[model samples]
Target: MKKTSLAGACLLALSLMMGSGAALAKTPPDQLIIGMNMNNLLTLDPAAMTGNEVVGIVVNLYDSLVELDANQLTNVKPALAKSWDISPDGKVLTFHLRDNVRFHSGNPLTAEDVVWSMRRILHLNLAQASVWKSYGFSKKNIDQQVSAPDAYTVQITLPKANDPQLVIYSLAALGNLGVLDSKTVQRHERDKDWGNHWLTTNEAGSGPFILETWQAKDVLRMKRNPDYWRGEAKMNRVVLRHFQESQTLRLMIEKGDLDIASNMAISDINALRKDPQLTVDAVQRGTMYYVAMSMKEAHFANPKVREAVRYLIDYQGINKALMPGYGVLHQRPIKAGMPSTLPDPGYTFDLARAKKLLAEAGYPDGFDTTLRVLSDQPYLNIAIAVQSTLMQAGINAKIITGTGNQVYGAMRERKFDILVGRGGSGMEPHPHSSLRALVYNPDNSDAAKLTNFQGWRTGFYDKQLNEMIDSALLERDAQKQIADYQAIQIRYDQLIPAMIPISQMVDSVVVRNEVQAYQPHPSATTFLRDVWKVDEGDKG
Candidate 1:
């Protein structure tokens, strides 16, 4: 749809929902329209993108070596690499590339491109490079460790004793390591930044869709790649429009202007659950909604103060009341329901205990602090509730709300006192995923610049905890590894870490029943290539 049409349609949908409740309008069956807030999407460049909103879009525009099963996350399936094999000692991986595949730039996809992409990640040392560096890949050794033996074969030799499956899962799920056409990116490089500036809004990949245009915080449009290697997309085009107001997205979905609605309020989602025309999918994810405190502040630097803040949180109450469509009661550092996860530690909302702890920490009358949160729904509501509770304990918390860029950017720079956000790199099924994201801090110096690690962002560090997490990852014994993980959680609780997990995240997406073959991936990599819509009259 054109911009003029979409604007007119938005006004019509609002009038229909508010004025007369007439028969709903319909969108073109050959196109897919999604309503969501684009505030979190800063860049389309996969290597520099931060949030899940960008990940969902990048996966459709680029193809990685493999894809993890949406239902069974650990199950790896082939994509550009038709087949792969691991060495007997599990130190080397060999991937055989598919033949005749071409990037959107018309350049042939080869093992050399795959190797160059991996090398580019380390060479840049941006947000995406942290994971590869943690796995022992570095700018100094990437060219040697990642090699393309032939046009059709690529090999990655582990630089350290690491679990090779973890590496494969990162390759499949991160979305940042998607192979880029080296020649295309090289030509677009600006001042030797390796095309970081141009690829911010443009793409160079061999995925199922080709980006037509993107206007930040407004709309993004992409069309199907007719000559895609695997198959063409079912829809001719995909249109994503930004709807800042959740009610607007709900109204558009009800009027058939939006084929799907994402990031809506819990109340709106519940009201639509009764509508037989819509189906609400609540995909339970591994990420968690957390309350993080910066240890850089003298008050929070005291472990007793961190423990006091923990008691000030109404975990059970928040999950019961404010977190219906958002999350469930989850308290441990590791995500619950996994085989290795431990039970909740049973932290409750006790204002008296919080007051007592605060008094003992030398703040007899509590203290003042600023709490940072995104202006989006759920986060703002959660922060409000937390602020109220903090006041009850004589702690005055001033709420400051902003866009995702402002809120997360402040946390990344260690410039905030308190933060309420949802994130952790738990896309993989392994326990190490969450630990590496939420609690792993290898270096805590000002010059280390480990902004990607949340623990480092909060100035939370413990050498013992870091060692345990690392030792558990490389442990070859299954039962032993689980025990090690369980021990790590216990130690984290005892230390009163800077971040507190309140609830596990659940992403709810509302879709019209007429849409078929639309499956929301647990890892946010929802593919649109196989999705199609059926007309109401065709049901017979």
Candidate 2:
């Protein structure tokens, strides 16, 4: 046998890594290539965008008033806002803008842009408008609520008495509140849309990146804004290539073609964890994976039926079997690890009790129902497991699966009987954030069309619960506020909620070894400006 030279052995190893059908795609040193699914990305407009994928991209394209620290979530750092002050009444917040900031179009970023950006959300009444609307801001009151005091100052006077801190957190954490260049956006305005149509493809921000090109479901590329007020992004270019197949992402990351991969299957993620050059970053989120029942449904409308259905769920089996890389066993509306979050109620799979309750609700033989869930991984798995348990309790539930639009759209219309999904506003590190999203339905009327709130989507509304959430947010005493949140969780559970918390969300992202400072934020406002890369070829 002939002995190969050391360099020849290295070459042989490289060839083996790039297996058959794998392109020898080497990402540039000054470029960061990320592989993930972009199917949920419907729009580039911050005000219209949903999903975590859009959050990360939009934050880089536009700067928010403040930013939540990826490591210290409670710490709100100044971004476009240099400093801020809350009035003694807690109903007013004044933000001082950074004078040196300039949009990618070379237009100065000012208080006018900040106020206009916020007003536009209420004016358009799009996906992002719901939360602000719930805060009492509307097209009629927005101008009075949000005002540009001066060129350098923006003041937001609450339309209602609320926690100023939560409002600040909302501004910081939700990427939708990204400051837009009013002048640039106005130029593109047509049909009185406030540039919603134009901004779906274009951007007017003063962040570290400038949108270069975006092809739906294919590729999105952004070049570093060299004149960024925060300096410049470490990478010259960032490429987000869509990979619907987790296997493709696995292959690309293994071959050093992609620096980061998100939304990969749990099996693929576990397999990739074995690779020495890759690390899986599991970030815990405040959102939850829940089983929701629409109160509008006749069967689910009965409190006895709702309680029986809750008992029918196999929480332990689902969390242990299906929620390993995805989430942990969390059975409360508030996210796990928060000071105010309560422990799980220890509800187990008791078919006898479920049957008894079902009989009491006049469904002795059980009733047929439909379970709506996204066709994506872990969700469908959870639904299948749920379907099995529901069958055991004599409840015949047919699993209905579709794309995000199809399933969530049905939920939005309050037409879903049951839903297995993950949601709740975990963007802020506050208990009210999740409760407001999951439990507080201000209006039960169908005409409200508050699809952004999961509680509204499920036709779940409790007048007392809504008041509790509102009052708790306004409580200035720390201990009393915490008590209020704890009480809220207990009350939500006792009320036989339309939504049952199954597991908290844990997002896993696979990253190559050479990527540096790639912090995955819980809020999803993951700024890529600080992310740099060392040459992978420099490895010994």
Candidate 3:
């Protein structure tokens, strides 16, 4: 036998490696691997979801009656509902379901599923129940609120007249409104669990993907739904590997082992922009990071003190220094891009003004206080900056940093003095979504503790503001409704509630060159249905 040359020997080794699946493992054409920090993911059940990380995953597994337009976050587009009609009184909404949609378990989508899914939200009293409860839905009345008029018709009746647009948005937007496969979910129900325990790790959705495996703090894998109503996904599988550090994600993407890095630090994203093989996208999400002062605390009970806290924030300074490419200075409960959002009103870093306000509020020397913040980047840094500035105004703030649950739990329980956190209501470009959550708190009773209502949680309530929110919901005229929202926002600004909107949150993601049509949702959700990968030679 002739002695094999070095090149021949190398070719033989390469063939053997390829045969062993090493080549396919490097960058599978049919699979998309994502690296992101998913430690915050508490549940996959849409009703209990409280974080964006889970929404990014749930949106692919489930379909809503209506969806935010991919190109425009504000515009509502058809999803499971093909068309809808509003009653003359504006208290009833009727949606005509799309035909032939099937769940992952081969159950046909129908109006009954829609009705059951919505009623389950109220019955379970999950995180999303507060939104519906505000609209007069309750465990006792949910059956009356939602009804299936026919196999393909879903009719929802509000307890009172409301803006039909907002009503539709509340049911169709992201969050808990994703219709579940009723029969399949109910079959797995044990002791009235409402499939909550089962759905935490499994999915019965009809969206573009099916949940294959979900090992918390380990990995989440989803396979393309071949029977998807819209059509099959381009990729065969999508994997979200748990990666807490941004550096590990950077290395994964650089090595061609990951298709997308969803949660990268600002510094890493900026550096990745220079790499030819990676694309860095910094998009504004429908979110705001701000400081909340609990009215339960006597030190923050005065409106003057709350107003002073607004002026004490170094918004522009913090955005430019600590939040570069991650935040934009934004002031107002409603996010900037949405309809009816008021102008900034120019709350700047005015130490003297804050000091004067503090004096007028009977804290002439300023009082020592505690500021709670999540022990995470941006939150902790923002809290530190605010702490430094407040100290100058004689307000000695002791920063208390903890996990999101620890800090936000205190706020929910009305126990924190000041909290630096992020929140957004309607990622659908609707003002009601934000206003209803950030301003309206009709019931403050411990028995009626609407913890999901951020305003109620912060102990901020004004009967006038509540009435305005209700009136805004009742107004049917688009222009008049917008004007009403504007008025409500003006009142909120004057009242100086516990919250002071600081900056709009921005998120960045790095994707490899092989990926295409990767549009980031303004809500910071990841829609992987239309995402496809191309071969190196297929690159344009």
Candidate 4:
């Protein structure tokens, strides 16, 4: 399974949702209004925000103890902690706190808060656990890994000191830990509604911005925090309005209403580039656009059938016609920058081979399969293209389109014969984070049958994957690590679960010159602390 990439720039515009049916307003002198696809804050509670919408808001509202650098990995820098140290044996991690850091409520941050917050996260083990579980940790459970020696120092006790995950915690930084004031969480938990408490809606982050209001599915507004440890935000306020329709957002940007339009539709992308008022930040995402086949069916169970389906897909044609230059065609499961034992052998367009495989698989005339797809133009085009290509090989595919949530739910439930979806390929540039969920259940938890999404209950593959991952954890030799990785990739190639050979990405941001410091990161937008509203002439 490819780790989903978040390489795309944020899309949508805020002004379109202001919906008073009025004309586009002039850019405010000091305010930056941005657009997003949707804004559903089920809970601001860190424990509950596993999905994108919540994470989007929480990433702004809360401060993770450590932040993975601008590239999503490679470096771990201080957020709450000024510095940290690892024991010689790699069993204990100690940190020194930044001086005078306080929660939004004016309570000084202490090490006690760190311990309590971690303890609570492990205790509940819901959404955050999902994120943490992908960190290649499987103890009997989550409780066994964490310990607090004192207020300022956290000691994590691993089952094995040799595990590679010890050194890789920074890679999971954005998702793993958010430093919460232990006092607030404890009080809220005592009220038995921590998930719905005021703290969840409000926040006490040590970051440069504080949450002012969140109009669910509509808008999220944040104001600069004056006492930020990093220094004050030059911008007075940041407004993120959720706009579902791309055309509406395009109009807003054209009217000079929004300072930043995150997701501009394909139809509007070219036209927006002509506008002198907006700047488009575009990059190929680390996301893969592929079809997920159902494992439950006999036809899907056979590798030949899966290969035949792959044959039916005109990867090149799809990229040129449907996706246009938006993304590359995905053939294997692992994308670049992610840790995979699989090698990039790539894919071939073999129409003859596809027909042979289909005939051999008892589909001499080609069989029909429903392709569940998102009701978007890109996916719809891919679905139609796939159907046409499969017919050339004597297979029939029908496209069933719906909303994103609907398609995702159907995929999770194994409800579709084949589903067209885009997955983030390289969340972290490291292989451990990408393969951990798909290969073995991490030592700290029980969800071991994670990666074999085909419901392959075979102990053989599971044992093999676990042994490969564990050996990689133990490997101190550089050459041996590479060898182990190669072995893992070979196994992954053999298994062919959600096979995606190449990664396709769509990463771009469109910002007005007034909103300054709009550099893009692999994970998400930079913190509001770095965002500033500039003069009209200095907008870029």
Candidate 5:
């Protein structure tokens, strides 16, 4: 147990040390400072970012070929490409770009630039490169690659006809695959350094804003692009101020210092809802919060022990305590009714049955286990509720908490008996991304290496999942796709890799009344490109 530097302390510490809303005075609206509760932001490079903090900023500073729109369901217009056509087989895609789209460096965006940007992804094996596999891609799936048929048309062809969504996913995977100028990459390569120099901190994106300055671990500043590909951003400039204090964030929100704030405490969320000055809204998130048992802990390998642990969790109580009416209890890792929630009966909860099962497994008196949680406030409530519930069922649970990276690293190393985390699907809610990242082991499969969080890899499940994704691609029949999904979901239930889904927590955004046209997607970062401030003089 080591004390965290002030820069790393999240909202929970701020809520205790400083009164809620105290940090607001430190930042004001003329300043437009935004608060980030999560601490893990490493690099602005599209290839290096993993967590939401850095990605959130990247989303605003760069424009992708497509973006999730207001409805949060579909990718719409205003991407680098004005329009796109999908081939009959849903494999080949042709994008028609807008003319005169200029990068921040005053270079015109061309079809060749798109090719260079995407090809670079393949060449680099970037952190998010695995996401491209859905498009019939591996290390070498871009057979034909992106080609500039003309100045305004970029044609891309893949080897196989897979998901139509793949066309959009590839662009959305990174900072909108922010169009890279061909000359820029070539210059970097000539310099023997590649696009690493400029693409790292400074971007040549065609988005509404351009990166003005990035002070590592401190702040990121951007100015509205005058010659933006789409149109000008409403704000003159945006300053993303990084503060670890949750109180600082809430204060900023209350004092009109910050126009938008996220990752607020449950209590703060409830209180904010009562204020007319701000909007407290929630959407059904694609994220599923659950706990996974580490195989490294021998006792966790026992089915009875795992089931007992699952039963002892009071998910409903924890969710209610965290943010009343803000979440929906998840029956499976996926949300029910989502085309991908994947129905399974193993997600149900029963305390008595769990105790009985534990007894049958030779733990009638219950068992002692260690549970790890994140510094996020909601997780704290979950930890406490789970501890009390498990104790009643004859189990002793010790709770461990730390920063997100610390917890994630420990989980990857299999250092804890049980670890809690939230898994989110893409904007489309496709199961392939979550399934591969959490269940299928990349080491054993033909797929690229991904994060199999719970170590749930098994030959049977792995084979079945691949077959299901592949079957969906081969068959045009709706019924066949349904059947494949059912079979996969049933097998996943039998495996029970991670048990006890708490709920789906949506990405809630709080915006000022003066700010209009803000759009947020469950999967997309909270920054809204369509949103603009309604000027007092322009009030209709």
Candidate 6:
């Protein structure tokens, strides 16, 4: 037989065996396999997770009180909580839990479990603690803040008035506020560890899938939840195989061995769009890639120097050449596609303007500085572009390259002069969501150092900005609240904090022709429950 004929014969034989239940136990016919680069996965615990790779899995394994609509990014719908209400003062929120919802461990989910899960986040003080703290939640007052009046009723009382929609957004799945199986977790707790160590590699969620296995940097497997509250998944098993090189992913998908390619090179993605058998989708993500400067560096401390750096960015050049199919020019702290987002001021590349600003800041001769960047493609290329532009203004910037951890670690430690990084406070699709964490910093002391608050991390604080954030959240008038948020953006332009918005991320995912309803989240997390595959016969 010919090579192609022999391969076809073997595949037919395997399909026959799978139909006969001989191979069904190992690889089901309804399995959906995905390929991606998973080097960024650091932890499985939602409380400690900071990378998107882990969030992709966490969203599958856990349930949140509310979730973003799969088809519409801005709309919020009920998930575990069937209904909720807010008091007239906007300081109290009450959630009524859904009936008969059960966790993977077979324990019924309750209001007490929700309360415990939220308190656990505060006690651990993990990556998302700053989000809760921003709403005036603390370890000392957690009991008064979050309470379960009954088995199915959960109430949250905030210290100050806030936007109820913003609060609901914070409790959404993308926010990493997953409720846990408190009884099962307590059973496995060892010496007051709160099951933190066990949860690092285990599953305790109530979503459509259950964690089967996780091999660091190799593979993550999830089995369909037989008793899922949302009903059974169309696919029996979902497999995520890690591929460090995009070439391998391209070959596998081309050969019909992989169903989806989550991460691909820009060149390969552009080429894949031309293929008839593959479907490529590029969606706007709620993230921004920008440069952050540490105020501890005296040179960057000058407001004029910061403004000069903003003018130094060649946004149009970089987006056209380097960020094709990957990003678009977005020059605001609040990402586009959100309510109350300000229009771009159109700060184009002008070497003369940069030089003028430098001269006014008493640095006409320019000065030497260092810029830290991740030692990876796209970022490294962006840094190179920035280096070329700074040279025109006589600013000699030395590029220092390192891995994600090393570079972000330096930013977290306040050890870098200037760092190119990507982060956003737009997880909630609200202006306060980004403004409170990225630009507003009420306390600038070391004692209140919040790693999650990018503004606090870089020692950027403005009393007026902080007041504006608070006032906007508390304003009961809808139109006036939006106006206040718009005013905040104007003030942000005047105060050049640590960030200068460069581009908004545009994420692409390729899937085979058989896959349908594969909508990607704005946060880049995959939702597989709605995705289904059609056999060849079904297509005809």
On lDDT, the candidate that comes out on top is: 1
TM-score for candidate 1, please give it: 0.91
For residue 25, model 4's alpha carbon misses the true position, in angstroms, by: 3.9
lDDT of 2 by residue, 89-204 (tens): 88889999889999999999889999999999999888888778778899999988998879999999999888889888899888988999999999999999999999998889
Runs in model 4 deviating more than 4 A are 1-24, 134-144, 159-172, 283-286, 324-326, 338-343, 437-463, 496-498, 538-540
Predictions in order: lDDT? 0.90, 0.90, 0.84, 0.63, 0.64, 0.83
Report the lDDT of model 3 for residue 8.
55
In TM-score terms, candidate 6 sits at: 0.91
- Give me the candidate number with maximum TM-score: 2
The residue-by-residue lDDT of candidate 5 on 1-540, one tens digit each, is 222555345545545545643443433222345556545666666655676666777777666677665464444545777788988976678888878788777888888778777777666666656566545565565536667899888888775666666456646544536666668556656364447666666665666778788876567788777877557766767777765555566766776667777766656666677777778656666666776776556777777777777777766666656646446666565455546456445444588888898888888887788888987766777777777787888788798899876887776555677767766454454555455445554244324223443434212235665566567545556566656656666766666555456776666666666566666555555564555565434665
Q: After superposition, how far is residue 464 of candidate 3 from its true place, in Å?
A: 1.6
Off by over 4 Å in 6: 1-29, 173-175
Whole-model lDDT, candidate 5?
0.64
Off by over 4 Å in 2: 1-25, 447-449, 536-540
Q: Tell me which residue pairs clash in candidate 1.
A: none
Candidate number with the higher TM-score (5 or 6):
6
- Model 4 per-residue lDDT at 318: 74
- Regions of model 5 farther than 4 Å from truth: 1-33, 75-78, 133-144, 159-161, 173-176, 185-193, 323-326, 340-349, 442-462, 535-540
Better of 3 and 4 by lDDT: 3
TM-score per prediction, in order, is: 0.91, 0.92, 0.91, 0.84, 0.84, 0.91
User: How would you order the candidates by lDDT, starting with the best?
Assistant: 1, 2, 3, 6, 5, 4
The per-residue C-alpha lDDT of model 5 at residue 170 equals: 46
